[model samples]
Structures are given as structure tokens and as C-alpha cells.
Target: MAETLATYEVPEHHVKMYTANVQAALNKEGGILTPLVSSNAYTGEKSQVVNFIGEVEFVERSTPYGDTKVTELEHTQVWISGREYDCAVFIDRLDTLKMIYDPTNPYVERFREAAARKMDEIIMSKFFADRKVGKDGTSTSAFGSANTVVHGNTGLTVAKLRSLRKLIKKRHVKVRTVRPKIAVTAEDVDNLLGEVAVTSADYAAIKPLVDGEVSSFMGFDFIPYEDNGGTSGDGKSIPSFQDSGSVVRQLPVWVPDGMHFGQWDGLTIKISDRADKNHIKQIHGTFTAGATRLEEGKVFQVQSKNAA
Candidate 1:
């Protein structure tokens, strides 16, 4: 049998333009974990699992005068897998021509903003799902559960932040620096303000509380979510510090290298014409990516009680 070709031909120049536009938009989306972990790439559509090797501890032994004891380095593996993300923008023939002619087109900017938001959301959701939760234990030894779980649901405050840092230290989570990542919903912003009175004499230095510039607090790289309550396609809101039935879960704290994001090599923009006689042009942005928890021990969940 003969192959049926596409009805309309997409010009080389148009395809190039699509590629440039999509790439520029993707570059504008800055995600939290994108810089913290090492990135990897794969070739195929199926999920690719990579092994993460853990550190080995060496022991000191006393030997005979002329004899020596020898030992080999040992390590453990944590497996991680990633998938692809794809999105398409459809434009009518007239609209496409307008975009080509108008350098300051609002349409292009709107499209770029939407694409950037989606890119960030995908990475954040993956980060939330690929972590370990902590429990209400006095120390790290008595905390932790499976399925990307962490403990602590009490609201955010300076003292609670210190407790989280102490828990992280107790776990001996080796970190390159003193900073840990902490995310909070906009609603929690008010909770934090209540802890520090805005009318006090110290409010001058604590103005981030009033102006909303509190990027770091209590040794955490504070990440405030403008909208943490919206639901995804699966009917679940973007995972933030929230309550689960009787147990309330607090935010996450971690070392930079504890997680990783892997991307496929040939991430690009694809352009084509519609098969239907509508004369619509399709611009697609596609890339393959996966995230995994490299060292569960390096990440901690802070379990908190409901503020009464």
C-alpha cells in the first residue's frame, strides 16, 4: 500500500520560527529544583530508571606489624524514573500571519506566560510526589514513612523552622551549605505575620513580612506559593503544607542534591498543519523529563500539630 502524505506543507521558515518561540518561552520558566540537582537525559518514550549510589563508610582496623587489612568501597542504589511533557498551541492561518508581522503581539506574550507556568508546575508536582514524609517523633530515628511522605502540619513560624533545622541536623543529612528549601501557601503568609507583630519597633528589618519579600527565614530558602490550592487534572490541589485527615503535614526541608531531574536529549519544537480543511497551524513544545529522590535520608518532613 502507498503512504498518504500530509495535506498541507509547513514551510521551513515557519518551523524555525516555531522552534525559536517555544524555546524562548521554556527558558523563561525558572523552577526551584531545576538548579539544585544534577540533570540527565534519555532517548526513548518509556520510563528510564537510573541508579543513585550512596556513600560508603570506611573502618579503621589494627593489624599485625607486617600485615595490613584491606577493604573495598561499598555503595547502595536508589532508583528513579522520568517521563515526557508535551503541549501544543493552535493558531488560525490569519492569526499566524498577524503574529509573524507584529513583533509586539500580546498573543505571543500570553502564550509564553502560559507555557512558562506549565513548565514550572510540572517540575513542582514531580518534586512533591518524589519525596519522603516525616512523622511526629522527638528525633529523626523515630520518624519517616513510605510514599514521598514527611511529617509536621503545624503552621509556619520562627520556632517551628528551628525545630525543622534541628531535625535535619539530627538526621545528619550532609549538605554543602547551611540553607534548606521551604515552601508555603499564600494563606500561610498570614500565619507567619501573626508570629511577628508588624507594629513593633523591630518591624523595620522585618519589613519583608509587610511587603511580601521574605525570601529567606530561619535558614530556609523560603518559597511562598501565590496559589497553592488549585486542583490538577487528577482533582488534587498542588501539594503544599496541608492536613491529611487527623494528621497535619508541614512543609519540606532538604539539601540541594537529594533530588534530580533528567531530560531527554532531543527536546524541541514541532510544527505542522492540520489535516482537517480548517487551515489551522499547530505549534508544539515537547520534552522528556523525569525526577527521582536520590537520597531519602537527605530530605526530611517536619510534622506539626494543629495550632489550637
Candidate 2:
């Protein structure tokens, strides 16, 4: 005897449940860098312009009541345009009937994971890319080369961390105020573990080898992030590159304020039956967002060999 077929209809409550699930998943796994950067929501705007005021020199008073020295404040801006990202999946009515369980949950997980990775990719791309500056945001400013720590044909080590810290400190960025963070891959963490100073109990209180991760060292929070050689809109892997016959991973060390994420629309989901396509259920998720480097001094890159 054949199994009795019954009509399936998506409940309104089910749609709300799925939407909440997607939003929660995105917030939880939407990349390590997204939560660490400056994020803002916008309405009716294609792009966001962040204004920066340059440092002003304080003139010492030479006379008791001398004329005030007239000075102009330097103004620059960084423009971040929103980009749309989405994922869709369809489930045939027959497929749903044959399956023992609903497949929508698995598809939702995949979408959230991919979207999370994409968010990180956007941030990593902007770390070293040129920024749109000037009052009208028409001019372009290259990332300061002086801020980069050369690979030196080696993987990440304490020496590089110290050098990176020194460079940031030279810019007068206080650790408490700036809250510096460094994005590193598993290979980079392994290299650090191999070093005596990092793993050895004598040098540090926290043994990275025992913990199986580098939580924090040298006043910088170490965040494990895999680049996967992903490219941005400009078709460049700003996070890693080939140099000196070696694949160099461009790890970014930055303060939260140095990078920005503008969200035109937060993660949203829609599920409905496609009437024209034999009533197949469609799961669609999308978000409009963009990222940009806010300041050159607040962001720095550490280039290290990607090696075993």
C-alpha cells in the first residue's frame, strides 16, 4: 500500500522561528573580526562617510596676552559603500516528504557560516587597501607602508610581536584605550607555540601549548582567523600574498576604532512556497553591509611566512 500524501503548508510561526534562528546564528558566528570592529547601522544611505579630525599642535604662549594663533583643523573622511550578500536554497515538496527530517536547518547553518566568513573577508580586505579620503571623499590614501612589519622570511614569532607593538606604541596608541587585536591563522599560532618563550613555563604565566591557543601576549589579543586566500571586490587577497618565494600571511593588528562595519540591512530571511515552480519551498537569506579602514595609524600588518 502507498503512503497517504497530505498537503504541507508553512506556518507563520515557523517563518518567524527560522528568521530568529538565522539572525542568532549570524550574530554568533558572523566572523571574529566583525564584533571587534566599530559597527554602525544606517538608513536610506548607499554609503557611510566617517569624518576624522587630525591632530592639532598646541602653541606655547610666548607673551602674557599675545594674539591668539589662528590654526586650521585638518579634516579627512573614509567612505564605505554597502554591498549586498545573499544565499538561497530550494526544497522540492517530494524531497521534503521523502526525507525523515527537515533539511532547512542544515541549509540555514551553511548560509550563516558562509555569511560569517564573508564578513571577515570584507574586513581583512580593507586592512591594507587604499582608502577614500579628503573632505568630499574623492581622494585616495594608501595604507602607510611604515606601519607594516616585514616577513623577514619567517613565521610569526615573539620578535615580530614586539616589533609590531613598538610600531603601534610609537604612534601613541595606548593599550587600554585602543584595545589592540591581532588576527592570526593556525600556522601562525603553531609557530608561536614552537618558540621557547611562548610555550616554556619559565617565561610566561599562560602556556599557549597547554592551552592549545594563544589567548593574549605582549599586550595584544591574539585572534585565530583563517584567511583561506579569499578575495574582495577588487580581486585581491589583501590578507595574504606571495613574497620572496614564500606565501606570506598578512596578519592585521588593529584597534577596534581603526576599522568600521556599516550595516544597511541586518541579516534577514524569507521562506515561502514558489507557486510557479510546482510549489517548491524556497529559503532566502540576505544582508547588506560594507567595511573600511578608518585610520592608517590605528591599523598595522604583520607579514609572516605561511609554513608548517
Quick one: best lDDT, which candidate? Answer: 2
Q: Candidate 2 on 73-151: residue-level lDDT in tens?
A: 7667788878898887776544443331333556557777888877877777788778877666678888888999999
Prediction 2 global C-alpha lDDT: 0.74
Highest TM-score: give the candidate number.
2
All candidates: TM-score: 0.71, 0.81
Error of 2 at 157 (Å): 1.8
User: For candidate 1, which ten residues in a row score worst on lDDT?
Assistant: 134-143
Candidate 1 residues 1-308, lDDT tens each?
43222344556776666556545655565444465555666666545445455465666656557455555433433344455667776765454443542434544565556545554555455544533222321112222453223334546566666666777776676533657776555545556667766556433334464455646655666555444355532112234343555424345556667666667764466666676735566766666665555566666655433454
Q: lDDT per prediction? A: 0.53, 0.74
lDDT of 2 at 245: 64
Q: State residue 28's C-alpha deviation in candidate 1, in Å.
A: 5.1
